[model samples]
Target: MTKQQQDEPPILPEEAVADDSASIGGSSTSESQASLRSSILDYRRENGRTYHRMSDGKYAFPNDAREQERLDTVNYVWMLTLDGDFCLCPKNDISAKRVLDIGTGTGVWALDYADAHPETSVQGVDLSPIQSTYVPPNCYFEVDDLEKEWTWSTPFDFIFCRDMNGSFADWEGVIAQAYKNLEPGGYLEIQDSIWPPVCDDGTLKEDSALYKWSHLLIEACDIIGRPINQTNKRPAMMEAAGFEEIKTTRVRFPISPWPKDQKLKEVGTANQVQLVHGLEALTLGLFTRVLDWTKEEAMVMCLEVRKDLKNLKIHAYWNGYVVYGRKPLSSEDK
Candidate 1:
């Protein structure tokens, strides 16, 4: 593992410094509980899609049913990338006490983990209340933003975050908060794909719409204040947050089923499906709102990008990173 140079620290947004109030708690009477549920279900509709109303414009992706399906598909792709492992960290390190899943969209990972380890209590937190009601008894869901201060009464033994590429304005602050909210000798694992994908062969030409779309999405996310290329810099950030035994693994996720290896072909096939399903969800808002592109124009661009993604000739792939670190044990424990 090569040491990574830290990028310039991002400025914390003023809006992100609020209290870590959870949306699941604080309702006393039944009437107030019903009112809270109503407010939480009040989603913002845009361009035929729905997003979380609590932190409007905070996350770029949609939270509607279509996006939820795409998220589940993406989860499968990540699991394939990990050879069906739920996590890449040392299995022994994850305590059977408390596990926290940050940005747990749809709560699939949390629910699965809870079902697998019945002894462990799992909590999934997200800005959207789109998780299903029929979840494992040990699993819980909450609507909360992680950028704010964390107020959980107990520290987590394992904290997991995945695919939160463009979800935070202050990545460092969130990592520090995770460190603070972790039990000593706990583990924090983050799995994310590096964006603006790289191509080894010349097949992914610069003139390709796929190439242009990738870079434009990065630029749009940057203009909107949540750059998606933060995956590569997370190790250094984790190190700076006083985490020890940091480990990072980068795997190539092919754009199409063009790989000769059977394993890579399977990964590529799943990735292609999710990418095709996610193009509009990932691009529509950014293109129309941030880049000043019209709705029709954005749709056309997505169409063009779809064509490029379907072309098996383009040897395009993203570098998927799974980074994990251990919060140091206290002096007496050592």
Candidate 2:
């Protein structure tokens, strides 16, 4: 989920707006009839105005300086958690083959994969069409909505999903779909952070701000049927979705750089840097008007909010569960 766009400059309003690059009074409501999508979208919302959309279905970092900082934090910190081993094996595990990078934000991971494995072909998909249109001969981008149905021509040897905590509604559905799309003996990897659940002094309490914040966010998503708080039981869900040989790893990152090991300490610092700026955006980005918080209160609370990320001993982390399985090989291989 790492990005390099301008931090959103406004707050938010619900509902999609018209593509004014087109004619007026012309069928804004008709999803089927829309002629073209905007190349550089800059639209107005209740909070003020917003710019080109990102994958989460809204123009985040909208209008507020603090919000952009928060998002940049989340994006960069999560990138740190992408351990090297996670990227290393798939190449050797399978012969040079086609791959899928689900939710390929900014197309960083996909590009990295392409660079590492020259023989493999990679396809990256996102809602915003924000990926660079120009790519290696083996890499391509498609603006497909994963929430709906996905139809790819070829079965893939590897599929990757990451940092989609704020974007997807049907986590299991998407996982199952990945299972369906994978070739037998192929592999799939999913990585996401556990949002809003804080570990206080290495213990997660029910009432901590992280916990409370998480609950509110879940409720907000429940209202719209697009909730994203499903982190704890991902392994079992994957099994149910038909993935086998699932491997789950929980890496507890310091919310704000507080690890004893030098290597891990660097990770903590990265998480902390992101934490300082992500507080306002994560707290109010979706919940303010949608959840209705006063602008003054959100700003005030955020000052103290990021401090929580610094309690290194507090053991705050966005747990990444990478559960992958092999599609059953055919009788011939067996």
Candidate 3:
């Protein structure tokens, strides 16, 4: 096999240990248990969409099953794009001792990584407590905000974050924390897709519903002080955070089933499914809570966007960027 192919981690068939009954903490009534209880009770619901109350509505998306399905589909699509590789950091020969997934979502990535590398300890942290209880023994999930101060006791060998488009208010702070919490020579990999798909042809006009939706979403995120489109700036942010040996790869992610090529056609089909399924869930809160749009108005806009998504003539695609960097071995190396 080629070196690049060899670098990919093999897909393991072993089943991950399940622990559905596990909660945040034990039954003890200690201070730590009380704190955990408070965190668990911090979940809030708005118009059927669940959100993390700890951050006080900092994260825009819902934590319901619809969002979870979208996330899992996106993750699977990414794996398919990478030929089953979970990460692109060149650490094939070395087994990461400790790994951290910043926005763990359902903790599927952490569980898969832990299952692949049984010797590694994988910790997935998120603002919501939606992660599955049954997970690999080596994998653990914690409820915490990534923008807040990190409380990790030890440095990790690798860190991974994906699909966190509108979650972080301060991306720089999150990268800085990752750098600080990573062991020297550790690697950090970030995978995110650019918003507002680009269309080279004239099929996607500025007046199109897709274009209008993208504009509104971008404007809303900008007003909130957490810009959603950071695909281009991530590499520079990592460099500024003192990470070295940085590398970036950009892939054209299809937005609809308009591509003639077989691989891209498959990607486009998956994108269409995700976008159609998540159109309402993705923008309902953003429109109502941020843009002051009524629920009916938001749904009308969503319907228009969905129609545009299914239009094969648009030929639109989002740029997916994978950026990875390593911590310097010593302070002088900086």
- For model 2, residues 209-281, the per-residue Cα lDDT tens digits are 5556667777776665655666656777777876677777655565544444555566678777766756655
TM-score of 3: 0.89
Q: Pick the candidate with the highest lDDT.
A: 1
lDDT of 1 by residue, 1-334 (tens): 1232122221111121112444453344668667767877899888888888876789988999999999999898888888878898864334458999999999899888888888889999999988887877788888887877788989888999999999998998999988888889888999998888766556788898998999999999899788898788999999989899999887778887877667878888999998898899998889888999988998898999999888877777887789999999871221
Tell me the lDDT of model 2 at 122. 85
Per-residue lDDT over 1-334 for candidate 3, one digit per residue giving the tens place of the 0 to 100 score: 2253245432221132112212443355568667766766666888777777766788888888889999888887788677688888965347799999988988888888889899998889887777887877888887777887887778898999998888888888899989998999999999998777776556678999999998899988888888878768999999999999999887766777677666777777887898899997789888998899998999999999999888777767777889999999884322
Q: Output the lDDT of residue 247, model 1.
A: 95
Off by over 4 Å in 2: 1-35, 39-79, 86-96, 200-212, 311-313, 331-334
State model 2's lDDT: 0.59
TM-score for candidate 1, please give it: 0.90
